[model samples]
Target: MLYRRFARPLLFRLDAERAHELAVSGLSRGWRALPGVPKEDPLLAQDLMGCHFPNPVGLAAGFDKYARAVAAWPRLGFGFAEIGTVTWRPQPGNPRPRVFRLPDDRALINRLGFNNHGAGRTAGRLARHRRRGHLGRVPLGINLGKSKRTPPEEAPSDYAESLKHLWPYADYVVVNVSSPNTPGLRDLQEESELAGILDALAAVNRARAEAAGSAPLPLLVKLAPDLEPAQLDAIVDLALARDLAGLIISNTTIAREDLASPASLAAEAGGLSGGPLRERSTQMLARARRRAGDGLVLIGVGGVFTADDAWAKIAAGASLVQVYTGFVYGGPGTARRIADGLAEYVHRAGLASISAAVGTAAEGGA
Candidate 1:
């Protein structure tokens, strides 16, 4: 109520990227003072990809690309937070005015181009958080991306370098070949290219596990929502063949149809996210779930704004769901509200646990 009625209106007045930076900086500086969300119910708890999530709702990757706010997530009520789309090399992203809001559509269009302080810097930050025990109570996943200057053929090595640098600090790593901002980044989603990258990361993961005497870190790929059915199936096949941990069902969509926002806003040249993406993302998730069955973990993202949306994703086959645009529009209380509502939904549906709800709708449809 406070965020929507008061904070949002005020924040909305600022430039989109500026408001984001301010919010993140404020949270990073004063997170300890913010009240934590209520304890999650056991029904909402989930064990996926070897990490125990206290709740299924998490903050998606783009919001904290630098991992600067690592400790603020759990306190803000998110079950987990995936940080970074950090590249192997530091690069200034696309020019300013890269982020735009579609308030009328409750959406966002951004072409920030994986702008971050780089993988090594992000790893160093996470290292400091680890030493201080400040990473909050939830799992932390690092989303890895190729350097903008790295050519398509060199993507595997680029991504591998990032994994090597950040391995120790990440609970899991998301291979991001899905963002629409970077030139030819989405092209890495092709079967041969994606398989090579996964293979490289898997080798590094094994070596790390042997050296550290810990379990091999989980590796999941984040896919673009724009993929064709055959492309998605091929990716799933490669994931299974390579023994990957899971997939983040989507990054953002390049499509521009069915938006309620102004024509000018819809004409922006970046991935579109929010209410308009809900149906497409959910449908893709359902398809992937049916193909992958119970063998893979799927984290649904895109257009999730409420418990009902999150629940729909879970039922479609996402063991976990993430929110980005929704968090921006809904504010700090969003995760808690969604988690609480999901627990109630589970009870009302007479499901034993959140896992019981996974892929139920997809299975019924099949």
Candidate 2:
């Protein structure tokens, strides 16, 4: 309440990126001050893609671009933190005025262009974190994508290279074929192209699993929200056929029509995320559930600002849900509040388990 009434207004006055840095730095400092995060009920615990998570709520990728904030985030009640979309090589990304806030619509538009400190640097940082015992108990995933200079034909090798570097540290790996800010990145979602990319990654995963005497890594493909139903179906079929783990339903959208922001704001060139994206992401989750059948694990992310929003995603076919803009809009306690609220929602609805409610709202039952 204090944040909604005051802190946010103060943060909004500064340049968005500057404000973001300050907030992250402050959180890191505060985590050092506290003893540790408090324990919570097991109602929030879950298993997805063969790994167990203490809770279903997670901080989505892009929040901690290079794993700098991993230790502190677990204190904030995130069951997982996906750090990156890190490329094989680091680049400066887009110029300033790249991030914009649409307060009227409770949304954000960004053309950040996958800026990161490279996967190798990120892995080095994470390895150090492990040595320092900063990983906490929360699971971590790494999202990988193509560097700006990389061409389409070479994209698979680029992603594979990143995987080779990051796989040792990442509990899971996300193939980021989405993101509107990157030119031609979404084209990787094309059936033939996507298959080739996954095939290459799968081959590497098979070798790695054999070496470790374990099962293949949990590999997920993040999709763009703008895909048509047929495209979604094709991707779902591909996921199952290739034995990939799951899908992260809906990445930031290139669509501006659904946003309630002014025409001037909508004219901005970038992906729009947050409250405006809720329904569509949910709709996409339902679609993926239906097409992928009962087996695919869906991580729903888009406009989850409240517990109800999280419940809506759960009931529409998401096994787990993620947030970024919602956390920014709702303050530090946001993830805990959402997780608590979800458990309450489950009890009130008399569902035996959260899994029981998956896809209840939309008929696209998972």
Candidate 2 residue lDDT tens string, 100-174: 899888889989999898878888999998998887478888899999999999988888888888877878899
Give model 1's TM-score versus the native structure: 0.98
lDDT of 1: 0.91
User: Tens digit of lDDT per residue, candidate 1, span 196-246?
Assistant: 998888888999999999999999999999999899999998888888899
- Estimated TM-score per prediction? 0.98, 0.96
Compared with the true structure, all predictions reach lDDT values of 0.91, 0.86
What RMSD value applies to candidate 1?
1.2
RMSD for each model, in Å, please?
Answer: 1.2, 1.7
Candidate 2 deviant stretches above 4 angstroms: 364-366
Judge candidate 2 at residue 247 and give its lDDT: 95
